[model samples]
Target: MNSSTHLDLAFTALADPTRRAILARLSEGEATVAELARPFSISQPAVSRHLKILEQAGLITTAVDAQRRPRRLEAQGLAELSGWIERLRESWGYNFRRLDQLLAETAPALEPERTGS
Candidate 1:
């Protein structure tokens, strides 16, 4: 996928709580579609759909083994996600610091006059 499409898929895949939970489960170890579906109240097909989204996002992979297809988490896409978040955080952090400095510099000028007559 192109970079923008990859990011769009990654964020959209993560937007659902079920998919996020699936990612968390996969983080522990690889699991079959049935195994992943077991914890949730949703049907196996629904879980399969979530897996498909994750796979399309490049967040997970599956391999066919006998009767089961085991899904495993892939780190590269997650690393890219983390990098994007960190860069945004850093940019905002710097801007906030600059704002704080400007506020500090202007504070004295905004002080009200104290007069006794």
Candidate 2:
């Protein structure tokens, strides 16, 4: 798990479609800047800029492979995002259970009393 601010940064990084696409590409495996940018019609520098943001957010990491810098997905970042989402889901589950209990408890109160009809 990570701090809220870091999680926020990761969320912000994922907000851009290009960055998201970049992450999606990294998910498959590691690739150099040129390889990553090949699918898009943007310049290599443009891709680098997006990669910088992703790297800052801890979503991706770069490795120096001789003449190339290969980028790959970071597990810690993915885990942090997954942890936040799981917490949210658990909280919603608790809330729904409480609501169900409340509804069940109130059902009898709304029923009319049956006389000797």
Candidate 3:
């Protein structure tokens, strides 16, 4: 998928609080659907649904170990998101710097406020 597509998936997957919590849980280590569902009062099936969305977004991946499927965070997905955000931050920083320079250049021309006697 293209960068925009990937970003769209990632953002969509991140839109849910439950999915974000699932990701947080996986950050510590891999977990089964049941384990992931422990924090929330939701059922395992619901957790699995959230997991499915996360998997589609490439934010998480599942590993098969016998009967159990454990899910873990996929670093690359987050890295892609972070990289995109960083680029925007850099662009904004450049714009802010130019604005600062313009203000500095025009500072002297602005008259100082006079105190009312």
Candidate 4:
């Protein structure tokens, strides 16, 4: 997939709590579709649909082995997401620091006006 579509798919997949939980579970080890469905109340097909989204996002991969298709976490997509989030956080943090400094500098000037009033 192209980079933009890949990111859109990854974010959309992550937007669902159920899918996120599935990813967390997959992180421990690979699991069959049935095993993944066991923790939730949803039907097997529903879980499969969620798995499809995760797979499309490049967050997980399903491998066929005998009669079972095992799902496992694919860390690269998640790592890319984490890096993007961290960069956003850092940018916001720097802006807040600058704002704090500006407010501190203005505080002394405001104090004189308050006292005069």
* TM-score leader: 3
lDDT of 3 by residue, 16-115 (tens): 9999999988889999998999989889899889999999998999999999999999999999999999999999999999999999999888969889
At residue 10, what lDDT does model 2 achieve?
Answer: 93
Candidate 1 residue 84 C-alpha distance from true site, Å: 0.6
Alpha-carbon local distance difference test for all models: 0.94, 0.93, 0.94, 0.92
State each model's C-alpha RMSD to the native.
1.8, 2.1, 2.5, 2.6
lDDT of 4 by residue, 1-117 (tens): 787798899999999999999999998999998999999999999999999999989999988999989999988888888887899999999999999999999989888544554
lDDT string for model 1 (1-117, tens) is 788899999999999999999999999999999889999999999999999999999999988889878999989989989999999999999999999999999999999988998
The model with the greater lDDT, 1 or 4, is: 1
Worst 10-residue lDDT window, candidate 2: 1-10
Greater-lDDT candidate between 3 and 4: 3
Q: Any idea what lDDT model 1 has?
A: 0.94
Q: Give the winner by TM-score: 2 or 3.
A: 3
Ordered by TM-score, highest first, the candidates read 3, 1, 2, 4
Candidates 3 and 4: which is better by TM-score? 3
> How many clashing pairs in candidate 3?
0
